[model samples]
Target: MQTHPPRSIQLVAIPLVLSTLAGCASPLQPQSSSELQRSMVLAIEREVDQAKAAPERRTLSLQTDLTKLEIRPDHLKIIEDEYSVDGYLAQLGALDTLDSPGLAELLGEDLLGQPTTMVPISLENAIHASTGNNLDVEIARYAPAISEAGVVQAQAAFDWTIFGEAQYQDSNTPQPGQALGGGSAAIVRNASQTTSGSVGVRKDLTSGGSVSITHDLNNNNVESSFFGATPVPNPARTTGVTAQVTQPLLRGFGSDTVLSEVRLARNAERGSVSTLRSQLIATTSDTERAYWNLVLRYKELVIRHKLLQRGIEVRDDIKARRVQDARQAQVADAVARVERRRGDLLTARTNLRIASDQLKSLLNDPNLPVGSEAVILPAHDGIEEELGFSLVEAISDAVTNRPELETALLTIDDATIRETVAKNLRKPRLDLIAQARLVGLADTFGNAYDDTDANRFVDDWILGVSFEQPIGNRAGEAGVRSARLDRMRSVVQYRRAVQGIVLDVKDALNRVFTNHTLIEQSTLSRVAQGEALRSLIVEKELTNAGYSIERLNLELNQQEALAAAELAEASALVAYNTSLVDLYEAMGTTLQRNRIDLVVPDANQLAAGESPMERAGDGQQAGEQDAEGDE
Candidate 1:
């Protein structure tokens, strides 16, 4: 002690000694908490790398080469001969009188043959309406309440029960009696009348036991026919009160066995709630897509209308040229293009109508039905801003939020609870039976009860045990095995659901990326086509180029190209917006994105006349404050 090492040296030496001992005991030491977390992170990264190396991911990397071909403007001048001057004048005069019969026919009447009204709605309003009024959502809303009822039913097993029974009997018998003095026997008649009644209350306990208290009463009148024979208290009354308890010592013991049904029902209710959430997500996504589709169709109609007018102009130019040098085939070709453009316009109109009806169908609003003639016009345009996203974060959100995953997990819990009950049932049935009774006898019912209460009567006590085991226990063993398999199946199902959700998230994200790129490329193509059309028109007007079949064909092609490019650009934008909807849905965040909350009412609430479902933003919800003044 006097030669003790310095404090710093002592600490270093102690640590070294402990380290040496630990190394000698085990070559591999347990990791610290921080080290374990680092290892888990590295494992996740490796798994992500492996997933990215999949064939589908590789396919996404391959790109289509789209090279823009440049067109050089032709520098040519037409000599103004008398015939050309006459043709130019003729074209100028015919421009005003040109008529497109095909277009006129299309615009003359409604395609659906119904009076129509245009109702403009925004994306948020559409989603909100669908969540509130969609038939699918309404149908799913009942499931959670039904499952809650099942929970109530399961819990009802433990409620107290009251029972009562009363019976009366009369009997007469004739018997031969022998005298005690050894004389000849005489025929005798014995008659009795009895009244009995019992009343009790019983209740089951969570500990796999039952306790019952019963009160029993009996009154009897008897007569004996014998010489010099009499009975004391010929009419007798008896009252007995018993308290009994039967507790299972082995099979059916414990809360796990007694409350298994209640636990399973609760799990079912959770699953139903998830199902409702999934329905809401689906409805929101569908409504958004339908709304965007209506917008796309409306834009396409405008493009087609312009394309038809252009065709009419080209036809008029050719007809004017026919006054000088235009051939019959040239005019016919121009007319054919006009007819085609008109047909496209008609088709676009039909599509717009169909899209409007689809949106109405999803909304199912009282003012907007599928059979209604009202057309839904989108008040909001497609979102054009780029969305920033990370694949890792997206997958994480899907794992945390997807209703299918939640449902799968709840199912596993349900299976586990059942398995516990089955295993408990495999044990031999052993029960402890105990009972205590107090008996009282008196001439009057009130007096008998008074004696029973005062304990002025004989008391009886019973304590016993019961043991039962099925031979071979085959049924019990099979049940345990079945439950074990079911639990394993549920676990596998959960994994499958997780994989499916991940795949859906990835696919939707890919679509969003692809469509965003398409929007950029389509915009460029549209601009290029517009420029080409302008250059062609300017060159023709400045050069006074005489109309011929080849010239007419070039003009028609350019007009078609521009219209197609415009339509493609609009379609791409709409697709990108719809892709976003799909991504949010896949991530189970559609309702959150739309600022809508799904509320599933409980069974009691439903029974009290509350709605089965209420949307958070809907003004109709009870106790909801109206941001706008109430009507």
Candidate 2:
């Protein structure tokens, strides 16, 4: 009637039935979610390579990308409550709207966006901020320039100077006659005009000393009642010249003394630059800590969500069973499930709030556009292969690279230099001064150069040695001793710092190695628990029983295993990052490998001491533990 089935149709029908029978007999293929996560983790490690290569951006953009990673609404619900439904929906909607490349595009836009505000500033900015704006940057910035100006002022001390003056006067000459007559005979007058000029040359001496020579000339005309009866008379000229020198033999209270202060100022300036660099380091470190805290909180929230989802599934199953079982055992199971989910949700919310606070503090801007459903993807997932290097080698690298240690060592050097300078200063100040001058006295400038005869050339010089023990040389000796002690203290501190740094490296290395092992063991445990759960479910289904001893035991065992895996995962994530922090801190360098901008400030530029603001005036420890805490 159907013109006989086609041979191809027959062949397909036969195979279809056989394939169905084969599929029914086969085992389910494993889902391999862990493998997928592992692959993603590997991708992250590769991304870190890029981050290290381009640290100038510091991967804030990458963090944004990570936050944009989509988790289903149900997944989000497990971590949050009904109150957070809108936020979860908003995040999902954003992810959907962006499509495949949306996250990357958003991050790129944020990272490279044009700055809305810009202001011209420099190192002066730091100084002004530190000084609370009352002190102008010019004052501190130009202090060295001003001190240099002192050298110019001292140079003027070596130059010659000339000055000129003129005066006119008129007076009554009949004072004697007026005195005798009691007032009437005062018509006669006397008048006079005088002009004067002087030239001097001063010389600065080599050993904290100076000397000078001076010449003066004057002319005047006068008329008197008793002498001339005329108002004007022939001018009379008078000239005088003198020379003197003073030398210091004890204290350095002259030109050469300037060297000491200049050296100290230069050192101080260097220290300022170091201080700025240190501030920059501190700022970056704080930023990083905030960022990682945000990341950790996100990971914890993810774990809570997983736990919540499992609880929900268990609760639903328990409720369904209770409908048929009519037993308190099923009710208890349902209650336990509800409690677990509720507890997980609360913990997740608390963690989320803490993370948000940390991130907000770091951004330092309330107006920043953060994603509604921000979360940090762990840098890695699952156990990774154990791989590590020697702690001793790590410590050696730390000592060589740590900037704080380097600064401390340089401080010792600076102190030692100061001590040597003090020792040199212990000797009494001595100086020799000499001066040569050509002298002439006349009414005019031309006349002043008229007496240049070789024999008349006045040459005066002095050679002397001065010594003052200062009764005890107390100040100098005390300075030397104190500086030496400081130098010694610095040396000791530097060694101690080295030891501490070594310990830091060792601790980080231990964590890394231990974490690797934990990860491996935890993975095995998780796999075993999953298998045991599956076996228990199969057994329960076959028996068609409720709250049986075998089923309860299996459930309890699986839950314990799940708890262990959760704890291990949390520890692994925290330790992985904390170890990295310790490593970086020990090295005192960023993980970035860029060599383009090679400029680094000298140790002198580091901050001299801890800042008051960073100090804990409240005298409370952030990480203090309870008395019952283990050592």
Candidate 3:
């Protein structure tokens, strides 16, 4: 008798076999792919949170006293109302005493050489217009919709599909008469005709399986030559209904493998949204910068104009006293100063025109196209008030809100999705295929179908497993390795993006602080220069008849100095405002800070005639209506 195996060995072998079979059921099961991606993202976010939690990251070492920098509401009012030609002359206590003729002719007309229509626009209006109509923003708007379409296309892979086919055949063949029992060898003919058709519906499952149900029909008419054969139905019909399923147990298994494309497409859609947000932020910041520069140019033009008026006055006084004490050299000096001022005024006008055009380009308003001759007169001036910020909060906001960081994080997610798919691909392909059929045959198609339906049928069943694998699997291994590397690269890129955003926020804050300080210092300088100019003018008047060349030169120098001081103060103020814009952009809060809400229209909304980009404010609505009306 054959000896039985030891009980211990048998037990071990049986469990091993079962475990092997169970392992084959699902060889590659991990956490949900989306959860994996989210976990990785959270890890990165935790790193950022830790960075923000550091004690040193909370406060900034600021040079300017934050409280002392608070500006009065009426601080800019005097400049706005008293920085004109008559205003300056009155400020210098010479409004009624100075006889400055031809000042209007000297100041000249519009810089563009044509009559300019002044269009007053506020910062909010410019931002609103940009959000709706800026060309860069408009171009970026379609990306998310296109990426969403890609997601739809990828999902279509699992949609149910209907299929059908039909075919006809006629054939003739020769057979030996001996095979038909003719005794002598002779050729005989056999003829046949057949018509066949099948129809089916199949669906791909997210679990990496496909199932189908089909109905088959065939009709045959045949004439046969055979030896000792009984007569059979000449015209016969065969019909059947079959169901089949194919599922992958190894490679291509699971939702992660099957839905990889869909996940990638979704990631792309999110990335495109981030890209659009970045473009909007950039456009808004640019528009704010241009607007403030326009304001600065306007103020500079005023300063230049007043300086020219003062210069002309000095030249006229010198000419009027030329015979008394003004030498020819002194007259020449005064005239030269006036001419120089005139040149400066011309330069200032050109700058104003340029700044206006820059704002128009960014706004892209149909009512104020870049090529228009109209000038944009800023209705709002730059804010001079100092603002305080927490470095930790700013960094936290940048990490949370920056779209570039989001896009980079999405890149990592996409790479993770691809890596999951690649690792699945490395598994050997093991498919479980199953099929069942109810078959029937009769002289007619209707009978054949009825027989199958009435249980007078032959039932067929098939169950099988097929496995295939490359000996080396080099391609699959390489794919997995490459995917891992890509994920690593994306992580690095994400870190780089975070660092870049933090740097931007810090730099922006520094500029804001510096510019605020400059504003205060420049204001003091302007005030002191104004007093010095007044003192010089008073001294000259006290010795009006005993005026010397040195005194006249001093007067001219003091006027120029005052003008420079005024320009410095205005430039510093504009810079401070622009720095605030940059700060908001760095923190990804420009739209929120400006009280504008960005609304990205979906494909359905676009089809319904909604604007591609919208802002939730009166300015945007009014701008859109105006644009449509213009069109």
Candidate 4:
């Protein structure tokens, strides 16, 4: 029996094969994690970004991608399950040239039939999905509601409360005077009963007054014998309504003090809402940046793959040499070049995978379960055009609209309100209190009520004053001092934020202009390298006159030029696009730039609303567009 190491282990053995090439097979040991990671990145880059098929070649050219790459049954299942069946079928159709009926006999069961669809991701979709679903954005969205609830809680302190009470009592007592009278009349009994009910509403006013309106009704019955003369009993009922109000004559006498907590809550709510917007802005920026990075990595992988192919072609050319002048040293150099390009291609592939994973994380859509392990194909591709803006105007816009600045301003307002309250609270406590009551008395409850309504009740008025002072008023004094200091701090913070944003805008603006210039220069450089490589090919004609070293030099020069050109093109694409992301972030307008407005209505409003997130990323896409730029 024989055992084999892991496939990835076999891949790293390419280096070890050099030593064993003197014979046929020498084994290499297991590779380290870092080595594996590098190989994985470069391999993917070479295959995808720098593949042999350009946008035009992909449609008509015969491809072995379906055969070369192992597309497991499970990968097909996951993709098809997520996307439409027809879309999956179309994707499978594109990869499987063997599916044609005549070719089936040769390809056997390897031909694809039902394909899986994978949701393709675009930069626009990524940003929108992140706003609606990213964990950070979702968590931050609750801040406004929490702060609004806090405001409600603070205002509850002054809400009116209705109160009611009812009670009944009975008592009996025996008098000793009855014993001195006679046997039958010896023991005289005294009995009494009373019942009362009251209902009222009490409220604390924001204007520094406390008031209550109450209605009271009572019924009493009494019977007694004195000196053995006689006994009389009757039920007496009283009904009265009373209203009382108290106002602060000095301390706590205005909205500044009485509604201070409510004011603070409202200001805090503004700050919280602004903070939430800031979080969303940051999330949008991150998602955009990650999406573009994925694009760059994909393209870089393509470039690396192309270079590796070129190196392999050169090595094959050397191997095919039939002339006596062909040297072993040239063949060795060609072999070395191929290995170098292959290693680089593998590393590029791994980094591209990393970039894709990052974009998936930012998207964070629940339905997109492929984020865990499956490959994601971007929805759209190709270089994008940009719109320019004035630097001075951009800086002004950032300072005016940045959420951080708004939050700071709100904080300062909150502090100012607190300072006013604290200053007022430091005064000695004094209040003027007053009350009014109407009393109705009668032998029966009905008569008492009638008297109260007929203007026959007695009118009673009461007035009073109260005053108190804390021994040192230390807490009040401290509150005032703290509030003042806090206000100053908030103002400073707001100023600092303004200065920082201005500087950031300037830095981003410069990068945008610089990267744009580089994009143009890189395009020219790619063309120039291509020309230089062609020149080397033309020089091969001169080498035919027996200059063997010149032939070797020409091949090496052409390969180097080709590699440099591809790298420059890929780098230019990344730089120009990423600089745009930086510019958007500096202006603090990521959400706006993406046309993503999460300042959304609540559930009820959304249900009744006219709009939903456009181009929102939902599930794992079904069919992937070709790796080339979107059609």
Best by TM-score: 3
**What is the TM-score (0 to 1) of candidate 1?**
0.79
TM-score-sorted candidate list, best first: 3, 1, 4, 2
Stretches of candidate 3 exceeding 4 Å from the true structure: 1-113, 172-191, 223-231, 319-333, 454-460, 545-547, 613-631
lDDT of each candidate versus the true structure: 0.70, 0.44, 0.72, 0.61
Per-model TM-score, in order, reads 0.79, 0.55, 0.80, 0.70
TM-score of 3: 0.80
lDDT of 1 by residue, 1-631 (tens): 0111111100012223223323433211122223322332343344345443432312122132333434332211121111121122233332112122332233334547644455556666677778887889888888999998899999999999999999999988888777657878787788889999999999999999999999999998887775424455557788999999999999999988899888888888888999999999998899988988987886676577778878999889888888777789878888988998899988987888889889888887765678876566665566664455656556656755789966875776676677788889999999999999999888888888888989998587899999999999999999999987896787677667767876898899889889988987886676567666766787787775635656777989998987888888888878988888888888788777777877887666655445533433344321111112122
Cα RMSD, model 2? 21.7
Candidate 2, pairs of clashing residues:
249-466, 270-604, 273-605, 274-605, 274-606, 275-605, 275-606, 275-607
Relative to the true structure, candidate 2 reaches a TM of 0.55
Which ten residues in a row are the worst by lDDT in model 1?
A: 1-10
Residue 543 lDDT, candidate 3, scale 0-100: 78
Best by lDDT: 3
Model 2 weakest 10-residue run by lDDT: 1-10
RMSD, candidate 1, Å: 13.6
